[model samples]
Target: MAAQPSSSVFLETYGCQMNVLDSELVQGQLVALGYSICQTPQEADVVLINTCSVRQLSEEKVWSQLGRLGIQKRRRKELIIGVLGCMAERVGATFFDRMPHVDLVCGPANLDRLPGLLDNARRNRGMQLSLAGHTSRRSATLSRAQDGVESLDLSRASSPIDHEQGVPAYVRITRGCNKFCAFCIVPYVRGPELHRPPAQIVDEVRRLVDQGAKEVTLIGQTVNHYVYA
Candidate 1:
């Protein structure tokens, strides 16, 4: 791993428990790569927003935050701004075209590439994106065998205890959804359902318990649909 230039990052999450887990895993990855977490966007060299697309209000909030970050970027040319999660997957490259200040946009399924994307964005001052796109059409068996995003969960760092809620943690047993309900965009943006190995799920839960987590929540788009052979 290339040594990151000393920098702090602020990640704001807006979504369900799944997105929360993604944000935590992403933070752990960045922290492992030498990035320090900051409490607010104003104090950071890198700012990322883990977004949701299930509601228009959630997307609007991301746009509003991006606008504020754009103004900040004008003052600090070196600041890096990124959009992650469902919104990035749904919007794809359009985010870069519409929000020129966003240096990086990564889909929920492509989060494993985020660290490299961030590194390139900061070094080259160019746009970087990792969307699911056609890759979402792959067979579940193929995805399970090749998915790099699985590492994001497997490599989770120590859990950070919530001062008020205690050490609450979330573990994703499955991802995406197979249900194509008329009003739902989850099937399109998050892709087909892929279940993690039952063994891995058990191991993750045990690990979280060992890490001082007092509460563990199992999450998924359609959690009950989870199945493994």
Candidate 2:
């Protein structure tokens, strides 16, 4: 029997270290699902842009990339385009209206649902979305138990290639921010601050160390405010 072709994905990330880590996790998820990472969008069956909304310039870059992808989508009708991270959370369904070529829109908080969303988008050839929205109204304890972010963090596969390259690994100890600074968009886009269990953080760090990670950086919107009750 002829071997099945392996699918490839091109993932571009913009913004902070948290987004970088998010991209790594997403890539790990895709890799686990048998998707190979490609260097260029034109060479892949799927394209994902993990975006930031902190500054207008950051968002402008995403717009430029989306415009390029829209042209690519016209040429390759089967290619999947996804927008993820804070921009996805901020824009919501408006992304589809503005960028009709995009097939999936998933926010940072909803990242655990991305694989299924990607599958549905691929199979149905339609829009798929996973956003935090008003669903974060649940109690902190309940959210921590139900929120899949912790599981997503715990499930991340430490990449030997990264370790060989001496890349500093990132560990997210908290999500979102409670400080609603007038100029900052983090609280609104990332939701309220939710600290991960210390045990999970320690486990993630141990896994990275076991994989030969020389440096590990803990990240969060308001990292100093992190506390587990």
Candidate 3:
């Protein structure tokens, strides 16, 4: 049988260390799915933007980038433009109306749903928006309980996904936030706080080191509040 052509993804990230870590996780998963990481959007079959909604400025930047990517999507008819992470969850189905060029709108909670969503997008030749984490296939409705962010689990064997070689990498040890300070929107956007397994964290750190990462910064909304069990 003839081999299939490998796909390429160009992932752009914005906001805090959590966003950087989220991008890394997305890249790792995509690489495993026979997709190579591309340096530029023009060279990629898929273009994913991991966004932040922590502040008004950050949200504005996300919208601006979406507008810009929409322009590029127009130029490249086959290009699959996507928005992931916080912004996707925040905007939900509204993103497609605002930027019809976006082929996918997946949330961090729904990262595992990307392959199916992309497949659906290609088959329908239209947008696939999966802001709600795990939707029922039969009902085609979102499970409100599953709409929370999925935390990094370290138990799985990883591929040789080198994101920032010979550079400092942001390693997400924890996810979400329980304490919703009056000024903070993390609790709403990220959902409840969850601590990753210590063994997984250690394994991820070792993997990062082997991948030429000089330094690894453990990140979370409240690093001090991490309770590994």
Candidate 4:
């Protein structure tokens, strides 16, 4: 096995093509911030789980994953663990209170906050003698908007890192949902429908193609409702 780098991340995602694409974007941004993607949880300086809340079972699995990570965090005080995506938005700040080991809890729309939060975690790791009672302090703040719907604020330059060199990739062209069906949780967790600007989407696709992506899948909860004109 190859030696782990000085700064590394282990990111895992659950549910949907959107979540996978979201993870890719996050990995790309973190890579730009000088973090390499590690293969396992044990080899990473930071571990982020991008969760889903489409069903009760999915959330349960996330909780179980958190329990496992909590054990690892107990052994390594400096390890940064975070929960992101729909589940994080659904639970909000209470997730920090519930899982004291987590360094941050942020929604999909708030991924821009990760770089700053991770930096804070690293800087405070050695300064604090005991993190026994400390929990992630990030709050879910909706600060950006487009057409009255909140923006997801994803990075446009994040091209997928395909192991096959030329595989199909998913692009999140739209996010959230407006229609709240009785059995669905998307609208609650992901919020209202927010479409990405056509220019930005075009640029991202072009970059992905340049990076050897053969095909692209545009993802959204209500893909039929997309109106970027």
Candidate number of the best TM-score: 1
Q: Please give the RMSD to the true structure for each candidate, in Å.
A: 2.0, 2.7, 5.3, 6.6
Off by over 4 Å in 1: 142-144, 158-165
lDDT of 4 at 58: 83
Off by over 4 Å in 4: 1-5, 125-160
lDDT of 3: 0.70
Model 2 segments beyond 4 Å from truth? 1-4, 142-144, 158-161
**Top candidate (lDDT):** 1
Q: How many clashes in each candidate?
A: 0, 0, 0, 0
Ranking by lDDT: 1, 2, 4, 3
Q: Write the per-residue lDDT of candidate 1 for residues 1-229, one digit (tens) a residue.
A: 5536668999999989998888888888788778888999999999999999999999999999999999999999999999999999999899988989899999998898998898899788579988889567345763445777787888765323342355688888898888989999998888998888888889988887777678888999999998887
Query: In candidate 4, which residue pairs get closer than 3 Å at backbone N, Cα or C atoms, i.e. clash?
Result: none
Q: Relative to the unseen true structure, what is the C-alpha lDDT of residue 207 in candidate 4, on a scale of 0 to 100? A: 70
Q: Counting only residues 3 or more apart in sequence or on different chains, how many pairs clash (N, Cα, C under 3 Å) in candidate 3?
A: 0
lDDT digits (tens) for residues 25-122 of candidate 3: 66766666677888998898888888888878887988888888878878887778888888787887888898888888887667777767766765
- lDDT values for all models: 0.85, 0.84, 0.70, 0.71
**lDDT, candidate 2, 94-171, per-residue tens:** 999999999999988889888888888878757998888965742465354587766667766733136646678899
The C-alpha TM-scores of every prediction are 0.93, 0.93, 0.81, 0.81
